[model samples]
Target chain A: MREPISIWCFSGVLLFIYGLLIFASGLWELAHPLLHPPVLHQLHAPIWWGAILTVIGLWYLIEFWPHKRASQPKE
Target chain B: MFPATNLWMVSHLAGMVAHPQSGLIAAITPSGMVRLSPVDLIIIAVYFVLVVFIGFYLKESSNTGEDFFMAGRQMTAWIAGLSFVSANLGSLELMGWAGSAYQYGILATHWYWIGAIPAMLFLGIVMMPFYYISKVNSVPGYLQLRYGPATRALSGITFAVMTILMSGINMYAMALVMKVVLGWDLNFSIWVSAITVAAYVALGGLRSAIYNEVLQFLLIWAGSLLVPILGLIEVGGWRNLEKQIIHNVGQTGYLHMWTTLGHFNTNPMGVNWFGIVFGLGFVVSFGYWTTDFLVVQRVLSADNLRSARMAPILGAAFKMMVPFIVILPGLLALSVLPFKLVAQDIAVQTGQHSFNEVLPLMLVRYCGPGLLGLGVTALIAGFMSGMAGNVSAFSTVWTYDLYGAFMNKKASDEHYVKMGRWCTLIGVLVSIGTAYLVQHAASIMDYVQALFSFFIAPLFGTVLLGMLWRRATAAGGFWGLLSGTLTSFGLWEWVERDPSALRYVALSPDAKAMAQDIFRALWAWVVCVIVTVVVSLLTKPRPVAELEGLVYGVSPIPEEHDDHWYQRPMVWAGVVFAVFVVLNVIFR
Candidate 1:
């Protein structure tokens, strides 16, 4: 149970999504010069970093939350 | 060929040739045996014996995992205070500062005060309360309390990787200094120091590291102070050195603090004041103070919250004194020896290896013999303490946060104690590989900063949201972490490709400035807090207990949680902030 759970998190579907965006941005830069050439390389940067921050945000929302108010006590 | 020859025009022409200013060039005679005598060997042996003896004396008390990690969690403010400063003030500052001051002109000193001094103050006061009250093993472990097991485990692995990487860099950086100063073989120093640090750290954990840190701190301060004093006298006093530098550079504004600085964004190649502060100083100072486990473990082990808070405060106090030792010597080195010359001297002194030769080269040429040995020993002391601190934290994290938390939460104190030693051994071995690989890698500081950004930024998000916002969920933590990482790195990669973004990245002329800026942004503690706070406000609220912990402290599990500051955490946090601000103003 623990092994699978940890692995799923590491693979991180969202991280992949961000990586794809960066790849696209890089490709975009190679094809078309937008703004300065320097600015173009910068375009890919935010996706992965943004993805990283988003993941952190979601985790904080989940962990500190109290267990849903019980319908009936376990006891 | 020209109409008239003015000195400033001559310098400006030379500056055009170099494309900025006249750079330093090294003067050295290579192909000679190191000055390391049997007396030097004896000095090393005696230092080793004392350090090891301290480890053994402290080891019996380190019978439990808790004792090994947090010194039975009985640490006081002052000990934690000094150890923190000692860990940071190392070969990096010594070599990097000298190298930069020599090459870049007067801009190096500005990098220290503006980039690090304030960041240290803000982090020391604002973040200390959380760590003191929460009492976790690694900075990531704090995340587990706020997020979930997955985030905690991720934090653990990354923290371990980052520490080992830094240890490897430190290993290489230290050996480089030795090679330059003592004229020893680079390979020889690296191999010997790696073994020495591993052996000592594997035997004793944070206790040994912290205890030894007290000694290193003293040596670092003494040797650092001694070097400049002697060098100034040797060069016919500060008056001559200062005059020569002003004449050579042809611009005295570099000496002025109020001079606005620029960075990659504005300058493309260098940084100015804005970049130094928001970029280098704000980012790196916060990351190290708030997130890095090597320093935090000392505070977390404190007897109570009061002691923990004081550690960073005192460390910052000491940080304010750094320019005296590291920065000023670098400035002195700049005036006396050009960087190019220093580089060549380092090569001759350190056998023509890479950057490792810079510091030791300066030491040998500049300082006299007795002081030379003392400075060399101090370098060793600085490095050993750093290696010890990292290995100690690594061992504790592996044993408690992972081994205990996952494999055997129910294990006895005895089992955990034994596990701690094994953990440290594993951690040290990992560092050996990292050090071996790091010699060939890019700038050690940059690589370390990059690795840290991956974990520390996200973990910072988890904890901040957990503390400041009640609605922060495990899911929220997960999302926030992912978001903040992408944001900071987005900034990082953008800067990397454009190079102009480097202005925002480090915004300092020196590696330490760059390191500090990148350190600050990579973690992006501010981004984490702001995002977590605003996001949580828009979301639902957590139960009262969770909110209470956000305000107060991580409450002990299996209780309703009373009196421990969870309910009134805001009051305490406000107090920490006010004190931090006051310290900054007075110190500045």
Candidate 2:
């Protein structure tokens, strides 16, 4: 029997995906700014926020990864 | 263009000034909508895919009735704890309370703090043991064990009806928000979210709903944490924000929680300390936190008695921090937004934004493309999770308390499991029907919310008495609950018929609508207790042997063998309560 996936892993995967997309978008905006950027556009919030999400996602993914040898439940 | 009734209803319920006839044509104009980029769409699409995948993955484990309805009772403290709190953290609540903070200042923080923390702690430390030991599947089941079948049936029927209607309100509110914030069509928003929530909850049952709720909790923080952070940075720091708010509003009382609460007229909320303490803190908070099956079901999914006890404590700790995300944005809007947010009627007439738009407006001010998508996804997740919570609880109560108890007593486990899934779909359909009803009438939303509030305080009185006092007879319980609910409804009607009756209900002419609500709950609870005590004294009591596990003193609590002091539920609850006190004091 296959082990059940932890919610943390699912969260980590989604956060990582979101972080990558947001980071890329942030970099793109930095290169070519929009016609009417929002307030504090100079802060590059998406880049930092995305990076923070990425690091936290990586940590959760590594910490809660399912063990290959076990079929028992994992918290 | 949206109907004037729809905009009026949404804006009115969202705590903006309601003028149903005045803003009919210009309400929610298309030019004001925020268009989502392709990147934003992808983020939302990803969320839908992931939730559906979770439902599919957990399908095999959810075959039995126990597993389907209660997640096989295998959730950890953190998972159950987060789901417990997240169940209440809906987008409507987020948007409405943020608007409340903007309109009423820091006084709105009371709802998250004193109004919630102590009740939640009481649930964890005092109530959880009986709930866990009784081995009941739902709150109604516990009532049946403690009181009688009549009390259980009454509560079960009311709860089942209330949950479904509330789910519909959530659905309609979400669609209305989507129409006002984005350019999304109302039907599209309603159908898509309803289908997604229905599909996942039906496929995976409670486990799917719980997991999604946990994920939604994180998504809410990820999406909304930016608003306060950026707003603070923009306006310098908390000190400077306070100064800016004082300069803007011309009053320093908006920053204090308790000081202005001495007199109703002194505070922006127009609620005094007495109402805040007994009405909100004791009655309304306890009613909602301790007895509401939607949240109690999450705690009941805990793997053990210890985990069950710890879950709400953990939830309370996190709950104390929620005002930072919910209330701070509104305060920031008061200080930092370049344009003044008028009432809904004026905003529609003048093409300016209203107070309820603070959260979305703040999101637009700070977030660009990809970040905007995350924020929007968070709101969607919050809404869908709320629907799922209501639907899932509705299914459980319907199957176990109503159908299984009354209709088919000899059904097999497989039969009940099948019934549960079918009920989930049916519940969603009914909720969708209700959403359309609200979309048409709009005034039904107010009545539906009032209907929900009618049950909670009196139900708490009944449940608390049942659990604590061995002499609380079944007849007493039934009459008390019925009278309490009827009293609440009667009070609401009286106030509706004569607006001046607010002074009688709320105890002061200076008291506002919020104070009236709080006082109404308090009075209903007091009436319930008085009636229950009077009736129980006359009625014959249940035998102590039958009340062993249901009543407090009669039941023998199992000693928790914790390896460490920190693992004790009492220790954590104490720590949480101390912090809660400090927060109230600091804010006061």
Candidate 3:
């Protein structure tokens, strides 16, 4: 029987996807600044925030990878 | 008058401005406000797809009634713990409390701290054993075991109705927020979110709801954490923020939690320490945290007695940190926002921003496209997860306590599972109906929310007595719960008819509407305890043998065999309590 998927694995993938998108958008904004950027736009919050999310997502993915072995569903 | 009445006026005014029927949507130009870019839209779309995928992924495992309703009782403490807290972390609460913080200052933090932490620890260490060992499917199921079918039925019906109605109110509130913040259509937001929540909850049952709640918890942090971080950085540090607030508001009282709480008139909330402790901390908080089935259902999904007990303690730890994301933004808004935020009515009339817009305003102030989308998605996720929690709990109680217990006792497991699924759909539909009803009348929203206060305090009194005291009779439990609920309702009516009655109910003419709510819960609980003791002594008690697992003294609690001291619920609860005291002291 196939092993049940865990919530951590799902969260990992979604966070990675969102982080990558946000990171790319943050880089693009840095290159081509808007007419009126947000208050703390100079801080490039998106880049750092995206990096943090990516790191956390990657850590979750590696730690909670759904291997073929029979395992309890640990969320 | 009442806070709910104030909310109704706000919601009604927002509805009038946003409703398509009023032709004001075009005039208001919601698109003129914070508009989501393609990146933001993609982020939101991705969230929706993932949640639905999770629903379909968990469908196979949810075939059985136990699996569907209880996640097969196989959740880890972290999963159950996060879900437990996240279930209560609704968008309405996030936004409303942020507004409250803006309006009431640091005093608002009491709801997340004193009003929550101790009660949560009590639930984990004291009450969880009775709930976990009794092997009940729902809170009403426990009532059936402890009291009788009559008490169970009354509790179950009220819970089921209140849950469904509250779900609808949440739905409407979310749509209202989306309209006010993002220029989304009311029906569009309502139908889309309702359909998604209904589909996922129906497909995956409790497991789906629980998993989504965990995910929502993370998303909320991911989305909103930037606000305080950026705001603090912008306005220097915490000390500077305090200076800015004092400079802005012309008072240091807004920054102190306990000092200003000595007198009702000293604090922005117009509530005193006595009300804060006995009324909110003891009665309201315990009632909601310990007995409200919406949260308890999550803890009940824990795999073992140890995990079940640890879940709320873990939740309390995380809950203590929530004010950073929720309340701090409001304080930041008070200091940093360029314009003053008026009351909802004043905002509507004068085209000024209202207090409720603080969170979104802060998000917009700090976040551009990609980040803006994340924040909006977090709000949407909070709303959807809250709706899912309500629908899932409603289905379980409706199927098990109401239908299975009363209507068809001999139904097969498969039949009940099918009924549970149907109940989810029905509950969502009913919620949708209630949303439309609120959009039309708006006043009904106030009354529906008031329904929660009526039952929760008295129910807690009954449940606590039933679990602790062996002599608490079935008749005593039923009468106590009924009278407590009626007393709360009667008090609410009295205050509604005569506004000056707040002086009597809240123990001070100076006490505001918020204080009235706290004292009302306290009085209702007192009335319940007195009536319960009188009736229980007069009525014959159940044999100790029959009450073994249900009552504390008669029942033998299962010993938690932890491998280390760190794993003990008591040690961690003690740690959490110590931190709780320090936080109160620091904030005081």
Best candidate (score: lDDT) = 3
Candidate that beats the other on DockQ, 2 or 3, i.e. the better one: 2
**Under CAPRI classification, how is model 2 graded?**
medium
Docking class of 1: incorrect
lDDT for each residue of candidate 2 in B251-310, tens digit (9 for 90 to 100): 988899999888989988889999999998999999999999999999999999999999
Q: If both were scored by TM-score, which would come out higher, candidate 2 or candidate 3?
A: 3
Q: Write the per-residue lDDT of candidate 2 for residues A1-75, one digit (tens) a residue.
A: 435789999999888888888888899999989876878999999999999988888888887777665555877
Give the CAPRI rating of model 3.
Answer: medium
Which run of 10 residues does model 1 chain B get worst, by summed lDDT? B1-10
Which scores higher on TM-score, 1 or 2?
A: 2
State the displacement of the C-alpha of residue B75, model 2, in Å, after optimal TM-score superposition: 0.5
CA displacement after TM-score superposition, residue B239 of candidate 3 (Å): 0.8
Minimal lDDT window, size 10, model 2 chain B: B16-25
Q: Kindly report which residue stretches of model 3 are placed more than 4 angstroms away from their true locations once superposed.
A: A70-75, B1-32
Task: Give the higher-DockQ candidate: 1 or 3.
Answer: 3
- Give candidate 3's whole-model lDDT: 0.89
TM-scores vs. true structure, each candidate? 0.71, 0.96, 0.96
Give candidate 2's root-mean-square deviation (CA, Å): 3.5
> Scoring each candidate complex against the real one, what DockQ results?
0.01, 0.79, 0.78
Each candidate's lDDT (Cα)? 0.56, 0.88, 0.89
User: TM-scores for chain A, candidates in order?
Assistant: 0.37, 0.84, 0.84
lDDT of 3 by residue, B1-588 (tens): 112433543474464354333322333353535778899999999999999999999999999999999999999999999999999887777888888899989888999998899999999999999999999999999999999999999999999999998888888888887877777888999999999998899999999999999999999999999999999999999999999999999999889999888888988899999999999899999999999999999999999999999999999999999999999999999999888887766665666777777787899889998999999999999889989998999999999999999999999999999999999999999999998988888778668768888999999999999999999999999999999999999999999999999999998989998898899999999999999989999999998999988998889998778899987999999999999999998889
Candidate 3 lDDT score at position B496: 96
